[model samples]
Target chain A: MVDPKLLNFDTLSVHAGQHPDTDHGARAVPIYQTTSYVFRDVDHAAGLFNLERQGHIYSRISNPTVAALEERLAALEGGVGAIATSSGMSALFLAIATLMSAGDHIVSSSALYGGANNLLATTLPRFGITTTFVNPRDTDGFRAAIRPETRLVYGETLGNPGLEIMDVEAVSAVAHESGVPLMLDNTFATPVLFRPFEWGVDLSYHSITKFIGGHGVAIGGALVDSGRFDWTASGKFPTLTEPYPSYHGLRFAEEFGTQAFLIRARVEGLRDFGAPLAPQNAFYILQGTETLGIRMQRHVANTRAIVEYLSGREEVSWISYPELPDHPDHDRAARLMPDGCGAIFAFGIKGGRQAGRKFIKKLKIFSHLANVGDAKSLVIHPASTTHATMSSEQLEKAGIGEDLIRLSIGLEDPDDLIDDLSSALRASRK
Target chain B: MTELLVRGARVSASCGGREPDPSLPLLVFVHGAALDRTCWQLQSRYFAFRGFSVVAVDLPGHGRSEGPLCASVEEYADWLAELVEAAGYHQAHLVGHSMGALITLEAAARHPGRISSLTLCGGAAAIPVHPGLLSAAQNGDDIAYRLMASWGHSRRSHLGGHPTPGLWMMGGSIRLWERTPPGVLASDLAACDRYRRGREAARQVGCPTLLISGSQDIMTPNRSANPLRNGIKTLAEVTIEDAGHIMIVEQPDRVIDALDGFLTGL
Candidate 1:
């Protein structure tokens, strides 16, 4: 009986969520690809349905392989539980839906992945849930944004594109003072680089499609509950504290205690919304997660080398990688994420948008893509791609510019990446 | 959730989504120290739906129950006896885990006619708390919680494949312990340590008894329960493979199955 508390992060990454198959002596996590499980009898079937027993009944609700990945992510992040979703967008949507009702409100960081921005600022309002967006650095702005109906304070660990580091401890304090939970999108800085729960963060979600999955082969997301937040104490979340009429008037907070949010999110959110991660995708993501600790080290090292190389290039106007002393959030990043700031960062090309286009076109090794956190290096221009949905004013508010080029540093040789960038910078010159 | 008045204090118990029916055979569940009724959610609800009327009580000063913390297992046993009567039951099937098992044993011995049957899960004749653990818990140190949660489950449970989908068993256990009211855990641990009459009480228990053990239960190994097995008049034992002290949550179905057969037979 080895105690899990004594296990190291690396050891847990590989073994935390799985064991040797008892049915078959398979060493790897077997992908349970079925849609439903066979019940031993009617009593057994009723037991599962009534939450009297612990077992998977339907695929959309829970699958064994997906459950393995959910547990692994929860262990890595130090959360009580996790629910995997079809995409990072779905995870965010499910979290918002689970917490918010028609008249609820949110306080959010202005610097966010564009999809998240759209969801908070645009789509949610259509359903009567409103949001107040503040700069990630303005802790006071978050405090002032709280309405009586405010249920959540949202931000990213490393802000998308801008790479602004959130002061999580400070923001979480503000959220707590207002009786709200702080949720961070930890996709940019995976658990390998940062565990949000160790700080004051109450909830966290991820796009496992990126770094966690390593390969860009899968698109998945997960919502993790720190189980520290007192939803009952908050008194604002009726969904958790009050009896739910759907499940025989079961109150989630009373029934599940610390795991109230996650259980409700699964039994209600996943049950009705119906966006679950495929077993095959979960298996692929699990493969990537096993090597996360080592792969992230390489990713961070390569990013540092590339950041240093870009600083000396005359074609580069500015960089926002947080490790640089001049970067606005460098000090905070150092204090919070001592292991390493993540690999994805944004920089400017001297010749503006046209030059940025040519530089991206000229790069031989870095693939131009709409995603980050891949095993291979990737580059994207947010203004024309990811953030294209946003208005010019929205882009400016998010600190995105025409010349801004985002790079997702990979595990390739640092010298090779630099060589490719060096030639692209020269070719990008007028 | 049912609210009962025991010893002039409010006591809460999960009645499996409905009020306990006096018509059905009463099944009362008692949770271990520093834990509450939710620990037996799966079992209580399962039995509640299947012909048995279940009431998994939150011990005084634990969970939603309101009262002063019991100073000893004997005090808790007195409270348990009164609780069954307050819930309108003359005789009940008693099921308890860890510290709760000790309480059930003492209650059955002291008020034998009130308990129709008794089931002990991860229990021993004597549970002596380590001095270091006692001191740490006294100070409300996190190490006590970490140690308890870590030692309570089997090594296999550390790597997750929780029968319950999406729940991390270890993390959930720690969180539940963290929610324990300040001073409550230390008091409960002290009470468990002070308990010295378990074997004697076991001999006095004349009810049909079942002892449930987990093969991987490090906290209360099978050998630790030798005194109880020998002392009890009529005993039935079931050892769940690869389970630990918290077998109720670790192997819920197995625990339920063991109880179902034993109680149904009675």
Candidate 2:
């Protein structure tokens, strides 16, 4: 039988999660612009709240447009379900909060977005939830970091600055052996380039603000549950396995089954914190997603040209891209994300921090920004911007050299991007 | 949720809490051929919270359940009886859809005292198979699945309106069939066509029965099930409008309301 899920990536991007709006015949997904849904009756309302039916009640809990985006991402990632959130950080927070409570712990990859690093190193600790950070290259460190109180193992699909490509299958094995689920932040490698679930990673999230919403017009996030992980077999997550006071003591795992992680994130995390993606944002994200497959193709091709150009430039000291043979994870990237490692990578210039700032100022086409995965080319000195507050020792540990320049390649003509970087590099040296 | 290895077949189920009340009778949901437990997800969760132990199985060779596909309805019924017993239940309320209904009917006839009550959806006792469909399935042609998915739904369902948000009924129905192994459907269709015991099986059912018919269901419409209904001395029938053979996805609320009322009455 031809599997419905076997449809090619390009086909699913446009047609996966939605049908035309039945009420008005809207071909495009409608923005369901309302705060609450009117129930069929009071009994219907009770049924929705009681988890006896599957339908929208409150916008904060679930909205039609947002649900469509959630479903689209789920289909893209081959997950049981997905929950769209206000931002990438909220998606990460929701996953952590749903899986754990006060007095719990986590093992995480230190090579992460600076914001996420702060959350795990600083903010989560204040909430009585602590983390043990492991070097992204150190698989043994991740396993050894686990304590009896550990809830999950967290890592990035591509580590910061250095482009550390995780051996997802190997790391997941260690996690499963200890009865824990491995979660990956797949913002850098969108589902078009890589699906973590295919590599045995149980849960994953993406910053829709990145390539997914290619135009960078919306700020949103998606949390995907692979449905392959057996939470019951782990016997550690009481939040999923045990009954709760809310919703008449319904244990999510027992009732929701494969979609337990997703349902819990929506009802408990989104319901309480109320960090939901606006229907408008969801619509924008969905529109961007329709072209995600094509956009990533251009993004990757353009990046390769830029990488090759920089390698030959005398003003460039070193290049850090997974496709480069000398890079530590080059072979792994070829195996895992064979289509492309990603469009974003960091490199160093002949000069130090001063010249890096000069290079950023000289570039006319490359916007100076902290964000990656935008349609317009962007450049930044990560050590000065994203990791400015971390101590020198912490900076060294994160592999963020003071001279490193991170570039987010765009869909512009490769000649223009390479020329713009070439002139900027010469100008910085002069 | 429970995953058990019952006599070599992997049985995946959803029940009440970690441990359920033995006094409260169990309701076990069986899916049609070429579909798994996910089709019943919406209903199972609802019933789990409604104070009953609800179990929806991914019959052998489907979804997470492992198997060398049973070639007949009787073999499937025997497995169901053993699964319930393995889960420590003496009796259960059997809820079946399409091919699943034939299995339940056979189980009722074979083990008269094990089933407390029976609920059949989108099914008829003598479910005759289309010859072309059977031939295509037997050949394991990919086109067979596409035809089954497209022809199985009512015109309204083909137009793509699902009661639930973020779900496409046509896409969902197609995926369910595609998820099953190649030759399972052909064998199941053959088993249904050979079973000519609708009236006899219905007479042996010694408990109340509920029949949920889709008003527009071309696969097993109300007309096809008339004889089965006549055989049941104690029975109730409900026909939901604008729904097809997959009534659960088309009008979940109405189906649940009718089923809930009947179960509550019992």
Candidate 3:
């Protein structure tokens, strides 16, 4: 098998997990929509069922299109193998389920996406697994939060809307010292800008909804295993080390080696939960991945221009782009994401809620929608809509204030966008 | 000649009631900002049996009536008058809520010849300016949750711990307010600032007006009702005992009773 780390992302996107199909000579991956794949014989089926063989038996376990996406993602992310999931939340759920069971604990960053934050801080406690949330930038914070039962340390590479860049290497160091793995959500900072594996991350997940699809048409997620973590040696991941009653005593780590985490996630997690991505959605995302390089480059460029434009406006009371010269995280951003910061940033208007409402209403070019990652510009007020369920205290803790307006820059002409925003700002101020 | 349409401007649908009647007296409803003509669903249908034509109009940038959203209540009223004229109604009864009620009063003030009577539900001659709301909106919390928290129900109404759709109403209200074009809200609020449609405009209205207020309405209280009562020389009043600012949804029965009694006198 070819090592993905050796190749460039642009090249890997097109060629990974894809070859000229020998039977049909199909260049494009054909969607194998069938529920089950037939075997050569009863022995072949037995081996497949017994986990002794490596062939597709059930679509729930894996589909050809989903497998292609998995392989392509694994290659792009520099991981040994990957698992595609129904949604981003499901991917996080599966990752937690695969690694930690009852009595286990997780250490995570406090400044997380609201949904993820709620799930970790509030929801997971209901399931008997307590989570210790600390600042991702604190290398010692991760270490201190870890209890004896801590199985993982998790954080997002570039925190959503908050845009706080995590020191992945520092967190990884803390996790490694305690015989644990670091999982990073690389959805915002796609491999195009920053690959987490390069910073010693053991696992990375993506909410393919954002940036990856480049369009907000399909909702999907992926989990990429770095294959560097020795689950058997760590002895912390019992599912990987212990005998499997489901597959007739087949130990995952010993049998599948680097591919153990992904295989188990597919067969045990996805198969039981039935959260596999549809072949059509996988196809849509694949098309989106094809233009990843160009889209991300333009997204950064447009976002920088927008940040600059909004910062200088008299109507804008505050701006929260990390790339701003005086921003506390600018230096950290420079050291971490040297290429450019991600496309999302938040700003406040001078007139407060009324002015903000007027500005959004006056916007002719930008679409007012909850979704992001569309080829078109999108805007939202986090406090009033997405984070409306959270209390003011929760919003403050997450660094989200009511005045904050998030902008997801798209591949539009930056000048036109600036003009539209300028007109709206001028109108709002009056 | 009173015509009603639900999804379009200048046409009237049968006041949607659970009854089978074609010749009901029309209760033409004109909704305020953040709501379409569909807001009269409960009233129109409930009173459809009383031989009433329940019709509602979507003001410009409101429901099906599309345009650059109006900047002021006067502009919305002006548009409502034109819609009434277009519907070929020489005289029709009117009911409005909040900003819609403000616009309805403005419409009655502008085109008295086209209106038979008016019902202002949870309305006032003036809206008090909230600095925190304007500040928060200007600063981009256009969703206006804090504003909703302050302006929605009276403190007593919200003492219950159960979550209700009223929360979504606050969210919806903010979204609707925020999603307008720039200067639109400023213009609307500015219109409110410039409005002096108290006893004077009501007196000039030259038609019977009914003022229905929610007891718990923070936006418009019984004190504000003094303006409508003093203005419309021919005016009646009904206070929804325990309702909120959005009395139509909060106290539908009281609203209907007020409208029923007021309309019957005609």
Q: What is the C-alpha DockQ of each candidate?
A: 0.59, 0.27, 0.00
Q: Model 2, A236-349: lDDT tens per residue?
A: 898887887896677776665566777788888889988999999999999888999999999999999999989998888889999999898999999999999899999988
Model 2 stretches with alpha carbons more than 4 Å out: A1-6, B1-28, B31-41, B44-72, B75-93, B111-117, B124-251, B261-266
Could you estimate the TM-score for every candidate? 0.97, 0.84, 0.60
Model 1: lDDT to the true structure: 0.91
The CA-based lDDT of model 3 is what?
0.71
Q: Write the per-residue lDDT of candidate 1 for residues B1-266, one digit (tens) a residue.
A: 88999989999888876667889989999999899988888888788888988899999999989979999999999899999999998989999999999999999999998999999999898888778778889988878888887788988887877888778888888888988899988999899999999889989999999999999998888888998988999999999999999999889999999999998898
**lDDT of all predictions:** 0.91, 0.82, 0.71
Top of the candidates by DockQ: 1
Candidate 1's TM-score reads: 0.97
Candidate 3 similarity to native, TM-score = 0.60
Q: Per-residue alpha-carbon lDDT of model 1 for A1-430, expressed as tens digits? A: 1222555678878997788988889999999999999999998888888888878989999998999999999989988989999999999999999988999999999999999999999999999999999999999999999999999999999998898877889999999999999999999999988889989999999999999999899999999998999987889999998888887888787667788898889989989999999999999999998999999999999999999999999999999988899999989999888888999999999999899989999999999989999999999999999999999999999999999999999999999999999999998995
Name the regions of candidate 1 deviating beyond 4 angstroms.
A1-5
DockQ metric, candidate 1:
0.59
Model 3: per-residue Cα lDDT over A1-430, one tens digit each: 1111133568667766655565999887677778888897875565455443345777777777777777777767766567888888889989998888888999988777778877887888898888987876677878889898999999988776678777777778889988999999998889888888778898889999888888888999988877767786688999887777786554666444455677678779987877878888888898888889889999999998899888778888888777888766788888878888888888888877788888899998888988677788988888887777777887887778777888888899999999999998898887
Leading candidate by TM-score: 1
Give residue A282's error in model 1 in angstroms. 0.7
TM-score of chain B of each: 0.99, 0.94, 0.79
Report the lDDT of model 3 for residue A373: 73
Output the number of the lDDT-best candidate: 1
- B77 in model 2: Cα distance from truth in Å? 3.9
